[model samples]
Target: MENLPKSIQVIFDKNPKLSELITNPRLISNSPFIFALSQKLNYSAKGNEDEYFYRIVFKEGSSRELMTINSGELRGLPTTTCIEKGKISDVAGLERVELDNESNLMPVLLGISLYSSIQNSLSYISNLCVDIRNHQILEGQARFERISETIVDIFNSIPDLALDKSLRDAYLSRIVKNNDDCYELYVSQREQLRHSLKGNNPDYNSKYYYENELYLFKDKLLTHPVFSVFERLVAGRICEIILSGNYSKSNIQRHKDFISKAESDINDIMASRISDLDRRISYYKRDIEMDRNLTRDGIEYHNTQIEKIELGISSIKKQIFNLLGVKLSSFDLLSQLMSKDEIDVFLIGGNLIVNDMQLTSDEML
Candidate 1:
């Protein structure tokens, strides 16, 4: 459209992609806006198979003003309004005549601009995908740190107790009378210890046999009801001591309680982090789909990227389990991370490898 602004003409020629398209009448005519604009203007067209070119001249006193279309569906198109109003009558044309839009060049410019925007949007998606995916691994590792520390603290806090000689002897006597298997194992073990200790020249001065037998007695005590009851009493005492703010007070029950609480907290933390990654991934997918240039290959590549993140999520969960001995069947990382309310896995780093083979859906109790 010759009635269109001269600056708009510059936009078409400056963009290589748009310039190439406008020179191809067969391609440009396919768009309805371009076809309509071409009919409205008086233009001479020329071009070969490789390119089409056109020039348009407005008749003196033409009443209509050329307008540019702005539609979201055609995100690439630049608006003709962007050009200065005073420059609309400036001359624009190609020396070579071909099927061209002339004033209708606005559509071609708009299409190219849309394409550029799409590329930029796609690029954003690609970059964001990398971070969102990596975040999955990072978040899990953070939770792992907390849970593992709690576990180590619990294990280290267990108190060591000394058994009295008389109490030990009494517990052993009951175990020997009641549990035949335990009694047999203890006796067998003591005999083996004696056989080794008394070899050739036995050091008689060392009460090594009785000492070893005493050690065996402790093992036997584990099967005695009295000793088990005593162990519970010790645990309760330790818990009380710890709650009283005594540093030296250590209890197995306290440790167990702490571990249980830590485990629950860790589970909640992991669920929230995984959910965060999943939600972002869903958004990424939606934005990616919005790009008109999206290809099957592009989608497949991104899906593979997502799979890598999912595998990473699984690996991190396994690490947490290994560190804390807490495995959750609900944390089945193999399930699709993108599924609503399901695991949304994300990973960072291109060189990440899932080295552990222990990732399975089985509940590790």
Candidate 2:
């Protein structure tokens, strides 16, 4: 609060409603101001827009807190990301005002809060170590700026699990006895999965959070815990590696190469997936056309079969007429045999023998 200029504080004091906006959803939501603030902190590889949290709070009163996060804008919301509050416009005719100007109340308060939270959270997460068991790791979408705060929050929440530099490094690179390898095996599995799902069915779900909905997917076999110990350990180690300043130019170049290779691998997977999809679509389409052709051919074949059936029936009818004139008792007994399905039974049996011979011939071929 003291860090904020008196001029900004005065505007914030005038607007009590501003501070009330600080809640879990607001803190975690993807907004430009939050994104900018997260950038200011540099805690993780991701940015604030990609990050999410259950909730974040201010120990102080809501008024100052709102002003802090809002930064300089006195009247409405943040102008940094082009989002303004008050549902009003200014002299610019753009329906928004800049916070750098003290006339607006929203920006000034919001900016300060954003900065304060990031700085405090970074210092907080830095002090603690990581804890993991299964060697599983979870990656956040937020850039280093936003993720740093959440990492701190997670560390702050679970103070019991702690690790040092050596342990942290071990956790990141360690291989658990669990059959799944984090880098190679799991990555391959993810690739295989991504490959298997490459259709552009317009009616299919296209939500950005669809992938994150691992919990709702009935086919999904597993989902990462919101803050798994294994994930924490990996993150801690990675943070240490980035902050260490121990890497030479060669090592940094090696890391850059790894990133390039990873991106290339992903692109290759996607390309192959598209090609596979096109091939499958082609095959299915061809089969459909073939079915149409077969149907047209089948009409003629069916007509020919009907003619043969009619001839067979005619022969049976003539034989029955002859039998009616002779041995009527023996014929009545034969009629009671209930052998109407004899032809169908014989056809099924003969087809099985033909199918066996065809299979044997195909195998030999």
Give all TM-scores, in the order shown.
0.23, 0.23
> Measured by TM-score, how close is model 1 to the native structure?
0.23
Model 2, stretches more than 4 Å misplaced?
1-181, 194-240, 275-365
Distance from true location, Cα of 25 in model 2, Å: 26
Residue 276: error of model 1 in Å? 3.2
The candidate scoring highest on lDDT is 1
lDDT against the true structure, each candidate: 0.33, 0.31
Candidate 2 C-alpha lDDT tens digits along 287-323: 5556666675565654454454345434433533332
Clashes of each: 23, 42
Report the C-alpha lDDT of model 1 over 1-365, residue by residue, as the tens digit.
24224544455456667544443111111233233333334324433244343434345454234435556686654332322353454332223333333453433333222222222212222232223322222223343233223222321222110001232234334332323332233334334333433343322244353334333323331122222112222222222222222222133344445444534543444444444445545644775778778788877865765565466556656654533342211122112111213211111111111111222244222
Any idea what lDDT model 2 has? 0.31
Poorest lDDT segment (10 consecutive residues) of candidate 1: 346-355
Q: How well does candidate 1 score on lDDT at residue 260?
A: 47
